[model samples]
Target: MYPILFSFGSIHFYSYGLMIAIGILVAYYLAEKKIKANGIDPKRLEWLVFSILAGGFAGSKILYWITRIPDIGTDPTIFTNLGDGWVVYGGIIGGLVAGWFYCQNHGMNFWKTFDMVIPEVALAQGFGRIGCFLAGCCYGVETHAWYAVVFPEESLAPAGISLFPSQLVMSAYDFGLYFFLEWFSKKKKFNGEVGAAYLIAYSFGRFVIEFFRGDMIRGVVNGLSTSQYIAIATFIAGIAIIVIGRKRFSQSNK
Candidate 1:
């Protein structure tokens, strides 16, 4: 894994950080295209991206700090150490909350914007998983599968051994989701369908992927990871959205 990108005399870029920036940029580009197609103001999309970054970063750090306490201080000399802070689920929650608020204030169609963003989220997740692959974190159990990836000696792990490359697995699933959402959006009979499908697809993906994660994360009360809980909740929310949207459509047709 190429965890360390490169170093100047005193500066270095990590693969994880660089990949996340790229993902955000890609999301912005998609948003621009979507805004023009949907007849929304593209400027509002820029504000949405800004809010996503600010809130996602803050929430990711907060969850990471809470979990890494005692070993890593709230204030540390080196922030975002390779194994230190970052929880992907936290970033999702934060991004959703912040994006909703931004859309509301700007008088954008919140559900419609979410529909616009479903494909972008999949694309971002696809690339972000690549970052995890390069960073050697969020890896999985050892495997002899043809797809297995072994890290270099300097890498750290819960067991400090070469293991399954879960990050790549997730990236593959996300890319598939990107295609699915994109195609489904084109065929959607009404608004909110794309966004609903995203919640359903991503939730199912996370539910299965958690099994391969070698590391133990903060689980909800019943020993399910935070992501599993979120997945279940998101799935329910997706169902609710579909039901409500369909009901409204039927009523309007009356």
Candidate 2:
């Protein structure tokens, strides 16, 4: 795992930034390859990537700031710690909302675009999770398991004890999801089937992983992890999309 790729005197090349850049590039690469197959111009993939970048980053950072409101009153230093606020779920929400607006404004079919890009989203997550592993963030609670890692240099280590590799867990889940959804990509009945499935699968995985996350996190609702709550909502949304899409398919067929 590479937390800092290199250093030029006081400046550091961060693993998180590198991984995120590479992941987005790969996601865009795959999206460009598949765009034409979805009956759209491949060039528009550029726009979609922008939408994702704008949405994802804005969403994650904004959500992080909002969630830190309580901490602002108690911990004056919270404002100085920009790195501590980001949440993956927030990024997803932002990216989705932004991308949806971009598509609508550009007169592109939102559902079809989502169908074409969902697999790539999961693929990106796999790469991003590996970044988290290198940065030693998003890790698990303390444990003595054989796979436990003691990250002394990582800022997010759990109380100076070895903990579960929650980042690796997420990486594994993302990889599994990539292959599974790719296999079923052709079986989807409508434009957004893969998107719906991805939301459901990712939400379920995130929900389970949140249970093992040992890092300090804030509660946004009813003392539950903010991510867990978002996962539940996304999970239900995925189910609803599948149900509604299938119903539409049935009616169209009849």
Candidate 3:
């Protein structure tokens, strides 16, 4: 994998960073279209994006630190490597909390805005996984499958070893999820229904994907990865939100 896409003089262009930037821009473009369609001001969506970036970055870093506590105990300098080690689940949680607060402050319908925003989030995540693949991070376990990939020297995964293309797999899944959410949103009857569906679908998908992950950077506790636990909680929360929303809507129609 080409981590350093190119370098001009002292400036280095990283494939991972580039892909993430492109993803954010594309997601913002799509979100702006949805915002205008929903009769909401684009300025508010901009503010929400700001909140997501700030909070998501912090949350992802914190979770990463937590996962590396074991290593940090041995090498205190591990804490200083702030350029890497982020957990996507943490970012999602942080972004959700921050977005909810932004909506409350601006008098926007949290669930409605969330429903519109999540599809874009999934789309962006799909692109981000492409970055992961390019950087050779978030790799999959070794396998003899015909579809397995082999990383070159200087790559993140074990060099010269055949491994599952887990990053690409997740990226494809995220893209499919974005389309599904976008289509499902039109048929949703409640404000939170679309967002809830995203939670359930994504959490379940991640839970399954974790089984193929080769990296141990994502901490494990009690025989399950930290993400697995988070996924279970979020999945249940999603189901609860859907059930409550449906019941509330039903009651309102009576």
TM per candidate comes to 0.88, 0.93, 0.97
Rank by TM-score, descending? Answer: 3, 2, 1
Select the stronger candidate by TM-score from 1 and 2: 2
> Between prediction 1 and prediction 2, which has the larger lDDT?
2
lDDT per residue as tens, model 2, 177-223: 98888888889998788899999999999988888887655563665
Every candidate's lDDT: 0.79, 0.83, 0.91
- The per-residue C-alpha lDDT of model 2 at residue 193 equals 89
Clashes of each: 1, 0, 0
lDDT of 3 at 172: 98
Show pairs that collide, candidate 2: none
Candidate 1 vs candidate 3, lDDT winner:
3
Q: Using lDDT as the measure, what is the rank order of every candidate, best first?
A: 3, 2, 1
Best by TM-score: 3
